[model samples]
Target: MARQLAVALTGAPGPAHRVTLSEVVAQASALAVSGTRTLLGISGAPGAGKSTVVEAILAELGPRAAWVPMDGFHLDNGVLEGLGRRGRKGAWDTFDVEGYVALLQRVRDLPAADAVVYAPALDRSLETAVAAAIPVPAEASLVLTEGNYLLHDAGGWEQVRPLLDQVWFLEVPEQERVRRLLGRRTQDGEALEQARAWVHDVNQVNAGLVLADAHRADLRLRLTTRGDDSAGGSGR
Candidate 1:
């Protein structure tokens, strides 16, 4: 695992003391073996690779860890349309912030050895949330949840941070993050112009909200693509 993380960080430009992916994994591993259910959050603006980092850590940790993304708490498209928020689908108000906080509280309080907690999942293709789609079992000591609003402090979202044991915020260059958002929208079958419009009009607005409370995160990770620098540290 260390070798894989080392290779992933190799050739990335950053300070000599940059925290490696291995260290991140180590932190997660420590939580998993702590003999208690731990919830670790990964947060970032849209396109900041929150899912990518969470998936990598889960892959390394294997069966001891489980994923519970906050995307599952997104309000149904119908609900959004009824609320007249369909045009700004990814905004913080588009999510069921109260429901998400309730789930986090349940996950944090319930003993992993007692029962299975079913979490909802987001069907990106359909852009709707599916209930009871993800099962967090008895043995999964570390629950990793990633999303854009874990650090957000308003609109009923301020309750989320206290439930998490640790949170890592991903920091990607704005240009790169915007590029990824555009690519994702286009890949989801939007026309180029439509994708551009959505990225600028909808996603970027939400991104601003997520980035505002980033300082509350326990760790801040600067993840970059090939030819870019990788850097991160505790509260940096």
Candidate 2:
């Protein structure tokens, strides 16, 4: 796995730096299946398309992989309301970070003995996390987990980084990312203007926090939509 820093940012972005998804699949395959169960973490700001990338990897690898989304660790809406944080539900503190860490450790340790280790998954339509909704089978070589906070350093999130065998951060152009987020909000029943407001005021701020920690990633993935929607990444 590699991290990409634009040549302009580090000096001249490497022309030979172009990468494809096959390389990413090969890299992830090499990491986890080579031996013990490995956790592959994916981090990105909202709308950076972490889910899309994770799905692509699973599609490429098939049954050799399993998935656990950090979004599944979101505290209940009632808990958020009790904490007076309901208005900003996607914020880092809104999640059950402790529970999430514990689950990851269990996923790594127990899958070999347990027929399957169950993990929670968040349902956006219900706006809640359903417990034990996903299963990690014993045969899975790599477990892929994605969220907005894997590399985020503050608020006990540092615990997450150490648990993952490798972490990749997704990057997309800011304006386009924001657009995708707004579209998502619209699908959730928000009006166009309301969606835009939410992205600009809330989502983008969280995105900045996530991006700040992108340097911690083993890989920096650039998913360009400008052309054939090809994916590429670089090593740190």
Q: How many residue pairs clash in all the candidates, one count each?
A: 0, 8
Which parts of model 2 have CA positions greater than 4 angstroms off? 1-18, 225-236
lDDT scores of the candidates, listed in order: 0.78, 0.78
Q: What would the TM-score be for candidate 1 when compared with the true structure?
A: 0.86
Report how far residue 90 has shifted in candidate 1, in Å: 1.1
TM-score of each: 0.86, 0.85
Worst 10 residues of 1 by lDDT: 227-236
Cα lDDT for residue 195, model 1? 93
**Which digits, one per residue and each the tens of the lDDT, describe model 2 over residues 1-236?**
23343222244222223345555566676766578888999788888778877777888888889998999999999999999998788989999999999988887786465488889999888999999998888889899999999988889898999999777776776766776887788877899998888888889889889988887876676654335443332110
C-alpha RMSD by candidate, in order: 5.9, 5.1
What does candidate 1's lDDT look like per residue over 14-128, in tens digits? 3222345656677678778888888899898888777777777899989889888899999998999999999998788999888888888877777646687889999987888
* lDDT of model 2, residue 74: 93
Off by over 4 Å in 1: 1-23, 112-114, 224-227, 230-236
Q: Which residue pairs in model 2 clash with each other?
A: 2-219, 2-234, 2-235, 3-234, 3-235, 3-236, 7-12, 7-13
Give the Å shift of residue 213 in candidate 1. Answer: 0.5
